[model samples]
Target: MTDSFQKRLNFDGNIDEVIERAANNYSLGNLKHSELMTVGLQDYNLHIITNQGEYVIKVFSKLRNVENIRRYVEIIKAALNAGVHHPSMLKDMKGEFIHTDEPSGLSMIVLEYIRGKTFYDMDRAPNSKELKLIAAETVKINKIKFKPSYLFDSWAVPNIHWMYKQVNKFLDDEGKNLAKTALSWYEALPIKLLPTCFVQGDIIKTNVVLGENSQIYIIDFAVSNIYPRVQELAVMSSNLMDNKKAPLLRRVERVKQAYLAAGGELTEVELKSLYNYAVCAVAMEFMGSYHERYVIGETADEISYWMQLGRQGLKEGLGEK
Candidate 1:
């Protein structure tokens, strides 16, 4: 996707056409499997059936630099090798994730087929026993080197602040001020946030899958960022906001318990920081929802309602003075 335009991805205009080009690239005839397309908040995801299997073809018009995607894939591969329950790398095949310039000079990446439904599609949280396994797998990734400074140019602080300004500004002056305030809060945090551990940043159920073998697999690392352990929890909290089926507060406690049980560390100060970080992260998410609900067009609500919980947590945990 050349990205001469804005947030939209597929350069060819229609997703079907985009998939067609991908199908042609793979020399696939009209695939026996039905075309699968799942649209993320900001990108268009296409799944094309191939002789080998289903392959994910993702497009992003705005970011001409596909290096972010590359780094994430590498990180996932590293995490997988380091024991994160992630998709196995497709060796020697250009199918894991292929970045290419379209005829229009747009950019895209095709990922290997990961066959499984998202955890969100599951009827319930995988049995309590499964939860322990998931926590172990997720934290294993968090324990590794997730320094996103390597992706600063490709995607990092830029995406965060940009959305805060451009997207969140739509809400209100308070929302605008909240965005600015959150950034400063992170900058002036009491504890020194670690940068060594690799973090997925996106921990929503939808991004995770429980494979047929009862194993867990996390895919879609587009939002993956390198940050500290507590910061990782902040991102995870925001992800839970998008989950309306279950009460988020309960899920957080469970996930936190599971994470700690898996040997992840959490100091008292870190817990307090997590409150502020979660609030900041919540405000940031509302800003994103502002864009999704108003600017680009979407029906889901992810802002103020979710923010209210975060704000309350901040007030209670930080002690309103």
Candidate 2:
């Protein structure tokens, strides 16, 4: 739901109201300093430094309702229980997980602030040991199960034809032709239906934090959903590939080896199919994010960059030139 190039959307509501609510709900002794973080692409995150401790007050978009808010909180709690590194939510005075500001009409959640730095800021990829840790943690996270709500389960089973349609919508004639060719390969995959598990659907580097204790923390499960375990590999492949600057096959091989070494299982066919789907996943994200920005007469450097890499991945996946 967030584009790389899109400007940070801020909350139209008064910051004071949100701060007061957090201060009251979380029992922060006094408000020392409140800073609006411009890093978030989707939500307005306010870093509140109070006399008691630091906290992050996330004001969600109007698109999220009360029920959805509760579901998100539930999923995070479940992930934490399964040993995933993420901040725990702080409940309000009424013992409510979700808080709604009547004036802003936007829902908010306060979380315990963890002192860390995101991978994006570090400007480097995870080493082999770190990769294994990430893979192991992901395996544990998938085991934490929940019944998927109707709205939350759709991403589990992706529709290739629908993706082609979406990709075609924003591309020029030549670009559409390239996408069509790539998607044909994705359509031909014999993807086995694996058991659905809890996945942190978006595992981009920016969403990961390395704590002061050298512990790797995976944050931002806002995109979490029930999906075939292999689907997690699809997203991981995209993250590891890093738009093709890194050695794609080597990185994937190492990651897969580490994952299996950590007691994770994947059939040969499933691995191949997921790598193919990984290309399609990149195309789908391009259409949804940068392409949407492109069609509207905006800068599309990111879209063009990813398209070059995705096209290559698709070709390799299909054994075609």
Candidate 3:
């Protein structure tokens, strides 16, 4: 009840100015060129070319404090030590992981540009071997140990539930009723069957990079948190297996088997709850995000697309499709 919290930075400003300042901070003599790479609903990523090398500059649109950046830096550093492959965080000229522009209130981070193909770009859905590789890599990420921050505990295990409540407030009567039913179904599941651990919450196919020598690199730790490890599996399965063209449950089983083969553990009950968790998780995401866009008075077209997808996915999960 504190506030409707969304993770994205709703930042809009002069990127040319930001890049200029970042060049100074990172001690890059000159910015050879920079371009707006992709604008997702949540983030604006830029492909930056500097005198030294190519880099990806991320400017969070929403306002996140220095402390939040520090925590992510801590987590990333720990992940590195855990033998998890990821792009290195490029330090600023001042040796800081975070750069804050006082006037713009934008927090930026520079990452070494990684060259690789994501699973999304693959010509076809991943075969069993590739799926196993992804699962094994995920296990390696979950193995990293870190002390939990008290302030962050609120967003970890129950993030989906929290999102559902916030989004429920913005839904029409029918939407609210459907969400209630889904939440009721999800809440009744045996989610507590597995213990909590540090999970890289967003371990979907897109965040993975298959690099030279078949090295697997995981990126984007913005939403990683400590949670029931099965929730991690549930979320990832939901992400990778919800395609209508493919055999959803069967493909998910393969992924689950791959995960287990990689020394990942889960209870049967937890496994059975995957779809319910997935439905709620997906619903929570689109609902909260759509509501945010609505409140901000931004164009609803993109969010509407996701809202439709979420609703359809929920219906399918409920065997209504």
What range of 10 consecutive residues in model 3 has the weakest lDDT sum?
1-10
Q: Sorted on TM-score, highest at the top, how do the candidates line up?
A: 2, 3, 1
Clashing pairs in 2: none
Tens digits of per-residue lDDT for model 1 on 249-298? 54456667877998888877776566566655655555555665566564
lDDT of each: 0.57, 0.65, 0.66
Best by TM-score: 2
For model 3, residues 232-288, the per-residue Cα lDDT tens digits are 776666555445555345555776788889998776777776656666665554565
TM-score of 1: 0.70
lDDT of 2 by residue, 88-130 (tens): 8888878887877666556788888878877655656677777
Over 4 Å off, model 2: 1-11, 152-157, 240-244, 291-321
Pick out the ten consecutive residues of candidate 2 with the lowest summed lDDT.
Answer: 1-10
C-alpha RMSD for every candidate: 5.2, 3.9, 4.8
Stretch of 10 with least lDDT, candidate 1: 312-321
State the displacement of the C-alpha of residue 254, model 3, in Å, after optimal TM-score superposition: 2.3
CA displacement after TM-score superposition, residue 194 of candidate 3 (Å): 2.5
